[model samples]
Target chain A: MSKGWDPGLVLSWTVAVIVAGAFCWLLGDVFWNGLGRVNWQFLTEAPRDAGRSGGIGPIIVSTMLILLVCMAASLPLGVGAAIYLSEFTDSEVGFGRMIRRSLEVLSGVPSIVFGLFGSAFFCIYLGLGFSILAGGLTLACMVLPILIRATEEGFRSVPSEYRLGGAALGMSRTRRLLYLSFPAALPSVVVGFVLGLGRAIAETAALIFTSGYVDRMPSSLFDSGRALSIHIFDTSMNVSGGEAQAYGTAVVLVFTLLSINLAASWITDRWLYRESIGS
Target chain B: MFQFSSDTILFGVLRLCAIAAGSVLLLVFVFLVVESWPALSNVGLVRFFSDESWHPAGENGLFNLLPMLWGTLFVTAGSVLIATPLGIFSAIFCHYYAPSWMARVYRRLIELLAGIPSVVYGLWGLVVLVPLIRELQPPGPSLLAGIVILTLMILPTIALMADAAISNVPKQYLHSAAALGLSRWSTIIGVVVPAARSGLFAGVILGTGRAIGETMAILMVCGNVVQTPSSLFDPIRTLTANIALEMAYALNDHRSALFFSGLLLLLLIIVLASLAETVRVRGEVNV
Candidate 1:
């Protein structure tokens, strides 16, 4: 009985292996095709000849600037919402539930719809036009749900004993949150921030309209700038001989995402380790 | 007095931010309605459903979104069909068969897949999947290509959620099944799967939402032709693709019509999200 062949086990293993193999194939193909085109120059020079002959320097700058604006706008709002939901309001009640539901629906709202909204509300109504500011604000709306959810989980993990201790010491609620809960939840908040950053950086559809198609170096927040993801899309679809550059940009984007995710997991693991030791 | 005032100000600021965050969804809906009002009034809602094609420009322009709507649903349905079984099985393997370390690594891998940008997936689809499909058929970019790419894109969502669902199954049920001399497969199929049914359904619904909303990847591989796909190999365009492709140059009624398409997408997503939320809430209560 111990040695008999098990079809279920065999099938499951096969399915898992197939999925893993597909992932490896996809990542490997991108690297194999794109690595040759990436270098120091590619990282630091502006693209030329419609992105067929040069690097993605300006695109990288634009992506970073847009990410900066997105983070600056979303971090406070997301964290505040999380604090409001987790600390101030009862989760089982009306306003909290409504906020959570709205977030759920917003998270599920298609990025393309956000693109439309961003173009209408930010680019047109607000007169921001196709600029980094508009793109960042659009991403802020999109990233808010993810950030709030993760940060809320982090805040919820804080022991109530800590809060009680703060109260016993006559610490004000705001002071307790700042010195006790906020510090304790820093690891999760960082993880959430990194996740939101990754999403904001990888965004293409939401940024395409708001960020515009300009690939030059953006001098200010008001200037239109092409994002790395958009660059990848434009090169792959619009330009005829831009496959190499597209792959290069993709490699950069994937590596950025990989590093960010790895850093997040590392922080989570370290926090868990510290907890185990302290307890 | 200073401390109290400072605390009040901080709380006030945070409350304002939360309110702002919550109102964004409503604002998005209202703006889309306002922008699309012209199209809704001039073209009328009936034309949107009844017209023949999506010719939004020139004289006698047709504003029908049926083709794109069908394309979105058709592609989403196809991807869901392929991803659901594979994702469930993958989750099952990770939960029951794999060693703990392997399971951890595999779950991380899936998360990494989720983190990868949609544009990268789109690039890969265009360069790799499209060409592979082309060998099987004449034109490369087709509904099949879109489905395949979308299946890959949404697989991680389903797999991760299913994995969580499977993990949440109480250990007592497994113990009881084993005590009754049931086989592992039978325990999984009869007890664990049934126990996690609603959660898994929620996961599928969420994945469906993601697939429907996906734009760049599907846009790259679906050939972007505004036609009702006759077969899986035929070129098609999704509502998302239609909006992204045309928003650059569309004017007047054309632009308004795109906004209308977005409104439709928003409404569809809201329904899906609410359904998922309800299922999840019920599952939590039942568990």
Candidate 2:
């Protein structure tokens, strides 16, 4: 350690403290006002009077349903594309490069643009109407890039020696990929899924037009439903005297995201520990 | 023969998925262009660039988007300006000054910041940030409020990216600096930062992209006024916020004009993405 006070050290510490203080302030503000309103009834009952005097039961259901549809659609496509990129092709070359570039561009495209695309293409052109299906599918498009890149990185991190070893054992390519590569990359795959889930659950702009924001418990995938994020947006922005419920809903949303993030980190940490032990 | 055929089938399925994924970008572009075609033709390209304010309805409806475009750029620039230095300094602190355990915890904190929903940020802004700002000035939701919220939202991105960039600097350089009796702070500024310059630049570009694309938080705090902001306290609206605010009730030409704005935002995003990608690739080559 340096003997006395260093000016650079003071400056850097001050900057870090300021940044950390801002984060704490934001988190503290939300939790302090919001946590008191979140309880058992809040988790189980539907809202009334334009979300001013009731709980968020149906909103939770809708959020999960949208998340479900989004994951169901995105996971297979993302894993398949990742497999092709990392295992079946040279990424520096023609088709692979094109796919990579498309994903990079898609990842950066604004969420509202995805909203416009979803409304124009899915709702109107495909005749899906304003439904959970439209909203979930739009989120799927938004999340595909994250999933594909993460899973591709996972597959790439698997040692080439493992594949060679499987071949030496007379295992077929299909069996080797299914048994060897997939298991090895399972941790990263889960991380990607969780990351995508967090993103889909938090989206508001992309879902509002596509999902039609009904605030009703959806009977089927075709029903227009209000997601939790949209509920927060509406209750806070549009509805009058809806601040308390908005705080509660924001708490639920933030709590869900925190749990998801913690779970992802836990999984990755365990995987890394296990790998280090084995080596 | 059976094994070979099975492998071929697997390849075909995976290839199909890849192709489908690749085509989505093209599909988004084509769909936006097609949907906005009516506005592009009816309003004339020149009108979009004109200085008249956005009034897309009524008998004297003006389709000019210059104000909203300028608002988007202004807010993004403001946030980037504030966030870049704070993020870089915090990254430097975490990488070099903090203990390993503290660094790990700090990183988790940043990830948590990144994970919080944007709508929650908007809600917080509406209730807390706007009211606080309102105490300072009359109207709470102004360009300043939007800039402050965006700075908080994008800070984690730049910090994480800069941390990664700083970590990628070779250890040998540090060892040599120490051997030469250079102070840690001086060595960092003289050797480490310049070496990580390209990656830091990429981080700023990516952060700028995120700030530009942010919709809900900006919409809530920016007052949603369709005029050029003369000062930080003046109300303004961004292109992303404009689309979200007006999309529900918009009709005919107005609706198409919103999509045109979306198209413009998409083009801007594409330009930023390619720029960041080029910087990343060049950085790797240099390394």
- Report the poorest 10 consecutive residues by lDDT, candidate 1 chain B: B52-61
Query: What C-alpha lDDT do the candidate models reach, one value each?
Result: 0.92, 0.90
Clashing pairs for model 2 are none
Model 1: residue B209 alpha-carbon error in angstroms? 0.6
Deviation in angstroms for B163 in model 2?
A: 0.5
Model 2 interface DockQ = 0.80
Error of 1 at B193 (Å): 0.6
Lowest summed lDDT across 10 adjacent residues in model 1 chain A is found at: A1-10
C-alpha lDDT of residue B183 in model 1: 82
- What TM-score results for chain B when candidate 1 is compared with the true chain B? 0.97
Candidate 1, lDDT over the whole model = 0.92
